[model samples]
Target: MKRLSLLLAGALLLQLQASEPSVFGAGNLDSDSPYGLTESEKKIVENRQNLKNTKRKSQENSAQLQSLRERIDGLQTIIEGLAEKTQENKLKVTELTSGEDIGAQRDAKIAALEEAVRADEANIASLKSLLESMATQVDAINANYVSKDEFNALVGEINAFKRDLGKTLKSVSAPAAGASLESKSSKELAAEAKASYNKLYFKDAIPMYEELIRRNYKPAYAHFMIGEMWHYRKEWSKALSYFKESAARSSKTSFMPTLMLHSAECMMHTGDSANAKKFLRSLIAKYPASGEAAEAERLLNTL
Candidate 1:
């Protein structure tokens, strides 16, 4: 029984050795060999799992590369926009610098104009001062040449001479102390009229002469005196009327020739040329030997 057990143990040991795994060849199972097929099947399952992991990793890398390309395009657009903004800023800075230069030139021109105006004002002020000084000197010279007191004294002497000449023209005598002019005789009234006329008081003499005429005195002489007074007063129309009346009243008197010449002169002054010529002709024919006749002849030739 012991020997039979030893032969069975040896057979079992040989079978165990043949079933052990081998590494030198591809794992295949064979009935001739004692190894099992389980190791080869497990290797096939692991190869399938590795193939699935490699395909998933390739897909993830493709998605990451597409996203990186999109980010690069966005960065390029931002850089272009920044470049355009930088160019615009450069142009604005140039315009500001040019404006500053023009403003400086304008300021200088304004300052120069203000200086010129101030100089003109100073010159004008000097001219005005010089003109005032010249006017003062001229006034001083005029005052020295003709003083106010000397001019007034000269005027007074001339007035006195005129008064004396007027008084001399009247040759009337003085009136009696007890007699009033209104109650006096015709001769006294005539004398009073003559005295007033000699003093060049025509306004006073005219009324006294009129009174003599109312009393029927020597009215021709009174008319002559009134005519002379009217001539001196430049009343040519009034003087002509009185002269005509005196000549008509006293045709043979010594004053007729002179009266006729005076009438002609008054006619000429009054713009009555036809009447003046008639009077001048009458004077030349009636008083040929008188001095007034020669004067009348000369005046007629002018007419």
Candidate 2:
């Protein structure tokens, strides 16, 4: 169908060219010729005008098509550049991913070290139980050497003290009937308890600290201070319990260096020099720059 249209247009063009006015004629494009035009001549004139318009439009369309092709070529160059950049980024990502195995190996090593620390902690627990057993054995053996009359008197005194001691721990934990403990904040109560403790007024401090322990307000520190009081009195057997309680509550503490120092000293007094030496050495290694560590080092030599 398109080929047929082109053929008919070519024929019209040829006829228009043949019927055109002569160049020598005194005729202008806008004006009629001197002679009047016939019907067929007028038709040819109109066809010639139409052909000129069609040719002008075709030339404008060709220029637009050339401009479009140049734009497409520029866009293609940009696409190629973006593709190269994407490939380079993929290589950089691969380099980062390749180092993950080294991280995995390091993590495995750290896990092994944590496991060893846990094992040592378990051994320490066993050693503590052994110390308690030794103290019991020593008490039983000493009883055998005493005269019957002396043994009877000693047993009566020990029984009376045991009953009182058990009651003292429980009874002191309650706030006095008229005390304003509820009106104060836990921190305020702790400060008051610390002041009493510093003055060596254990009778006053023990109850306040015990109240804090009941409230779960700095329980570890409260236990540590109570243990410190007992340690000052050279009551190693009693102090060890509170020290263990403090350690169980929290191992990480500001007083841990001092706690460890005193714990080793407690062990030495309680006839467990071997365990005392081990604990002092551990404390020295753990806190090498602290004053408590210096004390632990001196204590370890004696053990």
TM-score to native of every candidate shown = 0.40, 0.41
Compared with the true structure, all predictions reach lDDT values of 0.60, 0.63
**lDDT of each residue in 37-154, candidate 2, tens digit only:** 5666667778887776754554343333334323322332333333344444444445545556557665665555555545544543444344334334434533553233423433
Q: How close is candidate 2 to the true structure, as a TM-score?
A: 0.41
Clashes of 1: 0
Report backbone clashes per prediction: 0, 0
Q: Which residue ranges in model 1 land beyond 4 Å of their true spot?
A: 1-180
Q: Where is model 2 poorest over a 10-residue stretch in terms of lDDT?
A: 161-170
Off by over 4 Å in 2: 1-183
Best by lDDT: 2
